[model samples]
Target: MRADADLDLLGVLVTRRGRLMEVATVLRRYGFASIAAQLDSAGGPGHRLVQRVTDRFIDPELASASAGERLRGALTELGTTAIKLGQLLSLRPDIVGPNVASALAELRAGVPADPPGHAEDTVRAELGADVTELFREFDPTPLASGSVAQVHRAVLHDGTPVVVKILHEGVRRRVLDDLQLLSALAVWSEAVSPIAHQLRFAAVAADFDRSMRGAVDLREELANLQRFGAMFAEDPGVRIPVAYPERSSAGVLTMEEMTGHVVDDGESVRAAGWAPDELATRTASIYLTMVFRHGIYHTDPHPGNFLLNPGVITILDFGDVARISSSKREQLEDLIAAVGGGEPRSVTDALLAITDAPPGIREDEVVDDVEAQITDHLTGGVDAIDLAAVTRGVAVVVHRHGLSLPAEIALVLRVVTLLQGLAADIGADIDLRSITRPFALDLARRRLDPKVRLGRAVRTGRAWERLAETLPGELSALLDHIRREGGADLRLRDPDGIADHLVDGLLTAALVLSAGELVSRSVPPKLGSLSVPGLAVAGAAWLRYRSIRARRAGAPSAAARLRLAERVIRSARRPGTS
Candidate 1:
């Protein structure tokens, strides 16, 4: 069972010794060769010798396996945390690429039902009641078992059907240990590697840590159910399962068992009298409504998560969801528009606006990537654009620029990708543009409503004000860092000129906000009642902004920003310089 190990005959040191040994064992078991060289934190002649590892060794079993297969196998062997990590990676085709991600999609975290009566014992302990007294009939067998909890169907004393979710014994402790390991690894990765820093591994790890912690706690799911139920209380088209708080506790939750056929079962969907076309359009609308109107949504859009009947769609599982702020939603709208319009520069601009690009990102390079993406996949035109390709295109650009997206935005994109996949699975004739157009129009109307416009204008001004206030402090920090690091003998060109530019930018920004305020209020000097002063102010602001932009013709591009960030990192690497 062992492959011949390469001997280095030197010593390499490592902390987390026991955990690292376990990890190395798993990695080696799964045929991951060059383990010491690839993942060795401190690489030296002693890396293998200190670790008693090989410089190169491949598992004969995995030599013919795809990279993804090897990864999936390794992760599966690692259990809960790794399975969840694989599931998350499956959603990110942009990071791992389509093939690898697709291969990872098969990871299932289902555990054997709570070892017979152990689940019942835990339920009684958590809810302070015996199963027989609480429910008219409690099923001993779990309907579904996950790494976190087990769900069993039960009926209340009132004969109402419900599902009782009981947390697995000590799952929290195991999950916590894994999350700690993951978070530490993320920090270490970011500290040592610029690529990991650009990818924001630390941020992703933190977010995943939060999500996983929430997952193991039944109360969080209870809260999510209550929040979603409140949101959809009046909407007949979309049904959120009702929660039974009286019967719930921190480790257990009881909820209405919604009855409908899963959408992934196509024949059942048809037999249930749901027209695929109508259902498809309705599903998209519901999701869009969640995004544009509700500002929050169930993160998972798998067809299996949706239960459909003739006139309604039931959304299951509130264990995970995402929320977007108004500003983020608007940025998403802009990105969608730019994607559909077939303008690479606009797409690039919108993408940059939506993501966390470095200070001096190269727009030209982003535009070129976007242009090629448009040529490759979007040239089928708006109505026929392959959204999956667009998603990949976006990932490509972001990765190419060493940029990172907000996790919510990435989840939204994942939802869209999943939704599109659902269309094909259910045999629905879908025109992506036509389906989105109505929602887009409604969003515009909602945005342009007088009250909404006014609110937006007010928020916009406050945001701009904050930016203006913070800019000098941020600039000072940057300069201080440069000086402290002795980076390029720090020099300034017309430092006070920055003050003038800031003032001009703030003034113009205010003028624009004022114009919106005027438009919203329909102030005096009317074209009929159209606020002539507002129009005039808007024009002036536009002109001023154009002039400022024209004068500053040397803005750094996306590529330049990336390079600059790298240089900054490199310069900061000097020993005790700062």
Candidate 2:
């Protein structure tokens, strides 16, 4: 399906030849000539061809670099949008593989602060007041700055301390322009490149666009802050900074200031009377509750985003978060249970349920892979098991089997990986299985509850009812199109006696349907002292038996027919053949 926003963005890119050439030059410089060639071949204005011809220079230093390193370097050079894209790709091991994701994970969005005056100007423009009017004290110097926004320390009129986050001037336009270029390139790549098509580049670009756009808006961050704050309001050990929405806008955010030693500072934490082991366990518990219980969790929990303020763990940066649907939550729960149960089939089933694997993939192969991963992790007796490694291993297996995970799930896995890093930073030994086991078991038990079963049944019944209501119209439309296009549009290839087999299958289906109708009636005719429907079913059984027997007797099956057809086509296309 084509999204209107994507189409609009594509149009915008097409009209900007200068920008397209710049993109092409950058791609070529990064040793991505093939991608640039594909983009040029896909066509834009004449400048694309011109750029292709003139852009002959390649960086020799990048020649020895791995693809991931080259890509990371290119993105870092491209500024905010590309850096953000790299950061987003870092979360998707299923798409880019663990090695590439690890490389991209090193990308940091740290940029020099915008001019001190620019920050105040943004706040004044967004809040519709001078900096003096909005706060009793507004420090001109910035506390921190990044590609997207910068923060300033300020005090409210009532002596409440807060930090003001202001979006950089002209960032939205530049980022959007880059996103548009990316969207256009992805659309073109998907159309012309097999690898791009397989990866679904356009969809990935669309998702990235949505994510970057949302993150760019300070209002979304404010909302995330408020929601997380409410979720942990009763927990004395956790601290979520309070957001002042009244003073926040799409381009400006004001939140209560949180001051503490950074969580990764073990010496400071110890000085504050908090043991590393206990602190790590509490941190894990807080995140686990957010994920498995609340179903909404912060996606980035790096050491820099956490703080140790006496007894409280202060969480910062709600700019990025993820949510899990109820069904997906259940799938995750089942996955944890399956791993703990040490059953290959159950693990495989849970993995398949959570991913979008292509049809006809070998179930036994996936099962074997899952078994191997589970066994490898289990050998260490829970505490030694690295959740991040296991998760990355599963993703590798899934990718090997031509499966893809939904973006939300991929982000969740990324969160798990980050948690492992956080654990390492705090020098804490954790049993991931022990931490997650109760939530999984609780979800399993809930599934077995009578109330839950009844609710599932009702949901299933309603779903079936809706399908029944719509199926006829959909089938009718399909049949009408088939009839209108005639049989040539079927695009079937039959060899030898395969067409006869097709006829036989259709006849068998007709007989089965007729038999069903006849059996449903209150009264039915008799054939040789048996019900007519019974005779019809017996006839279908005989026909099926005959068909199977013929196949066993070397009569060409559909697959064999296809092979024969291919051989004939190849022969016909050979030299001096018609």
Candidate 3:
């Protein structure tokens, strides 16, 4: 009954005639003329009410600010959905650009809280009980309200002090509607932009959909919390909130509440007589352990989620997390090695294996740019090298290469960046590179360890054994076909024809062997240092060179053309092959 009422209120709010106009006014006030224009353009004259509101509140001056700041303000004005997008953007500096990503990072904790009654009603509906019945005591007001949910302090019936999380009223519907609108905009942009071939806007929208839906699911959030808690169970310095398995539902989550001052707050740490720098370093080590050692990480490690106590840092919010498998973990280690070694070609190849990069991007140029940025920080003043600058540099490299990071990589970058900020707050006299290097090196070594190598060898051996068993049968069948097709008496008299036939047969055998070898070799496990886009260009370059070389080598016409035709056909079969 309570759920029905809550949903009814949401329905009314979404359907009300004045609601869209309210949203537009907020957007304009926040300096989002471009987005407002897109909305108006999509909605037509009926949306004039929104347009008029936008016209009244908008400041043309704000739009003229740096592209990044403008976007941050715009999302702020557009409310939760846009802010959620900004949060996603914060993780994806590669896609939104560094300037924008940095600004969005600053906006993560600023989302406005819904009215107290609305939040209370939401909690009641989601928990399927009144607050009093579910908790020893429940705070009516939210401790924090984020894009997806509001969290309140409470105690479970079992006397465990926990946080009760309730999804924001109508968040699901609003997200879906916003996603539909964003998808439409992407489609329109692709149709009109000359750069559409390079952008892959549709893919980005699809990714956004997947990320947001996962974030909004409370059950998934609970599972992540439990999973992370287990990973850190033996670590005395880190505390992950324990979820109440019996209480959590799709829209409600109950988890042990962790209390500590935020590590980013230096003044508070100073007041407590604690060493802030030590706390920062310890915090960074914790996240590094989660990412590089365990292969699972808290995706959203913005300072807000990190709380510092005397000997521990408690991580809150498991809604945004990434669990990388062994294969991807190995690839990431390789990517780090490629970055450290400054091998652009290897980086490019590794990046291509890991991500979907844009076409026509130059591998060497991207690698040079990334290397230059990291080298500058390394050789520059030690005091000057922090996580933020390195991250911004990485974002720049990602942008120049026209490659967006996968969600997992983006999350890792976010955690690293936040650690840098935490270190700076605590007066760490260390360079981020100094701390990151050891951990990264250790991970890389493990990635290349005998166990990893043995695993790769075993996989390859299995494939080879299968091929060995199958090949003789296949060859015998082919020989039988040739025999049945032509009795031994049938022979070609022309020398050129006979030579052509012999060469063609040999070439066929060689092609089969080459293909079989490729299949037998397991895919490389590590991402290389190059951006995905760079590798794609390198691949295209290789194909074009092969085609030109084959034509110039003075090979016979039919066989040469046939090989060329075969290459083209094969390339076409693979998506993203130029």
**TM-scores for the candidates:** 0.74, 0.77, 0.69
Q: What would the C-alpha RMSD of candidate 1 be, to one decimal place?
A: 11.3
Candidate 3, residue 432: the lDDT equals: 45
User: All models: lDDT?
Assistant: 0.71, 0.73, 0.65
Query: After superposition, which runs of candidate 3 have C-alpha atoms over 4 Å from their true positions?
Result: 1-58, 109-120, 187-197, 270-274, 342-358, 380-386, 429-445, 448-451, 458-578
How accurate locally is residue 266 in candidate 3, as Cα lDDT from 0 to 100? 68
Candidate 2 lDDT score relative to the true structure = 0.73
- Model 1 ranges with Cα > 4 A deviation: 1-20, 31-57, 358-362, 450-578
lDDT of 2 by residue, 259-348 (tens): 888765567668667887777667777888998889999988888888786788999999888788888877777777777666789888
Please state the error at residue 112 of candidate 2 in Å: 1.5
**Native-to-model Cα distance after best TM-score fit, residue 47 in candidate 2, in Å:** 22
Clashes of each: 8, 0, 7
Displacement of the residue 279 alpha carbon in candidate 3, Å: 2.2
At residue 423, give the lDDT of candidate 2.
Answer: 75
- The best candidate by TM-score is 2
- Across 1-578, the per-residue lDDT of candidate 1 in tens digits comes to 01111111011113345655777778776655443233223346654564344323556767577767877888888878888888887766545655666778778787777678887898789888889989999999889988788899999999999999888878888788778777777776676555566667778889889889888887888898998888888888888889998899878899999998877656777987887777776787788878888898888877778887678889998888778888888888888887777778788888888777776877887788888865467777776777767786776676556667887788888887777778778887556666778887887897789999899799988886665444434443554464466433212343334433443444344334443333444344355655645654665575456545644764312222223333433332333322
Q: Model 3 clash pairs?
A: 331-526, 331-527, 347-528, 347-529, 347-530, 348-530, 350-528
